[model samples]
Target: MAEPVRVRRLTDQEGQRLRQIVRRGSIHAVRYRRAMMLLASGGGNGVPVIAQLVAAGEDTVRDVIHRFNEIGLACLDPRWAGGRPRLL
Candidate 1:
């Protein structure tokens, strides 16, 4: 049997902060934070549960968690730097 994905626990402060974001209904940060909280709380703790809850794909949920873990809140906003500029 394959090992299940380990769910990360959110501190009380983190949980509260995430809840606030969800309540604000920003239509931007809310979705991301909600997913983060769900994942952290072991809600579906897998690709399918997260996808169903957030109406996104498994890959998306996985990416979001990874980005948040890597860069903190900045992950909420996607950054497109565009391709490398050509040096003339």
Candidate 2:
């Protein structure tokens, strides 16, 4: 079986930043969701519980946690391809 995923330990600054985003309610919805996931994980909630609390799929919660572990707070706003792909 695969090991469960979780966000790494958060510094005081990172924790404060996430709380600000969640409290202000002005950040992008996607970022808000990601921040919530990391905060819940840091608070000791497992992937499944976090998914239910956030009303998201288990896979999505897992992805957010893993992404946060890899990129820290930057995972909140991901950079995706903006333009259409060209046929090679």
lDDT of 1 by residue, 46-88 (tens): 6676667677776667777666666655556667589989899
Highest lDDT: which candidate?
Answer: 2
Q: How many backbone clashes does every candidate have? A: 0, 0
Candidate 1's C-alpha runs over 4 A off are 27-45, 82-88
Candidate 2: which stretches are off by over 4 Å?
A: 84-88
What is the C-alpha RMSD, rounded to one decimal, of candidate 1? 4.7
lDDT of 2 by residue, 1-88 (tens): 9877878889999999999999997458988888889899999999899999989999999888888888788889967878988889
TM-score, every prediction: 0.62, 0.85
